[model samples]
Target: MQMIKQKVGARVRELRNQKGLSQEKLALAADIDRTYIASVESGKRNISIVNLEKLIIALDTSFAEFFEGM
Candidate 1:
């Protein structure tokens, strides 16, 4: 679970960076708090399915696509 969370975080950060998005911007896009995004990126937060959906939508990806190659 921990590894999965961390990998998800790492993937988010990577994708966000690739898209030239800041944590705050990504949070806004996901309709989540900036701090929450930071916490997740820092590996200090457990991601819920709702939050994951937000992120997937924010990234314009399907869950499978979002998690692909991660």
Candidate 2:
């Protein structure tokens, strides 16, 4: 589970960077807290499905695309 969280976090970071979005930017777009984004990226938070969906939408990406190579 810990590894899964880290993997997801890494993937989120990759996508965010690919989209040239900062943590605060992404958080605002996703309507989540910036600290939450930081925690998620640092693998300290296991994000909920609803929040993940919000983040994906904010990234303008689909779940399949987001989870690719994971």
Candidate 3:
């Protein structure tokens, strides 16, 4: 159950890479820290709902859309 966040994080990372966006770029677009994004991608951070929304928006996706294949 808790692994869902990690999965979501991984999916986000995959999509970001697929779109040719660096962690720093995504963080800048999302108004978040690059380290934070790195942590999430590495499954080292348990993101808050707020931060999750920031990532979703940065990826230009909805939560449901972002999580569809996750």
Candidate 4:
């Protein structure tokens, strides 16, 4: 589970970077807290499904795409 969280976090960070979005910007887009986003990206948050959906939507990606290689 910890490894899964880390992988998800890494994927989020990768997509965020690819989209040229800062953590603050991504948080704003997702309507989530910036610090929360930071924690999530740092693999310190076991993000809920609702919040994960929010992030995925904000990242302009589908779940299939988000978890493509995972």
In order of listing, the candidates' clash counts read 0, 0, 0, 0
Please give, for residues 7-69, the per-residue lDDT of candidate 4 as tens digits. Answer: 989999999999999999999999999999999989999999999999999999999999998
**Lowest-sum lDDT 10-residue window in model 1:** 61-70
Off by over 4 Å in 2: none
For candidate 1, write residues 1-70 as lDDT tens digits: 4788788888888878988898888899999999999888877788899998998788777888777876
Q: Say which prediction, candidate 1 or candidate 4, comes out ahead on TM-score.
A: 4
What would the per-residue lDDT of candidate 2 be over residues 1-70, giving only the tens digit for each residue? 4798898889899999999999989999999999999999999898899999999999999999988877
By lDDT, highest first, what's the ranking?
4, 2, 3, 1
| Model 3 TM-score (2 dp) | 0.88
How close is each model in CA RMSD to the real structure? 1.3, 0.8, 1.3, 0.6
In terms of TM-score, the best-performing candidate is: 4
- In order, the Cα lDDT scores of the candidates are 0.85, 0.92, 0.87, 0.95
Error (Å) of candidate 3 at residue 16 is 0.4
Indicate whether candidate 1 or candidate 4 has the larger lDDT.
4
Clashing pairs in 3: none
lDDT of prediction 4 = 0.95
| CA error at residue 61 for candidate 1, angstroms | 1.7
Worst window of 10 by summed lDDT in candidate 2: 1-10
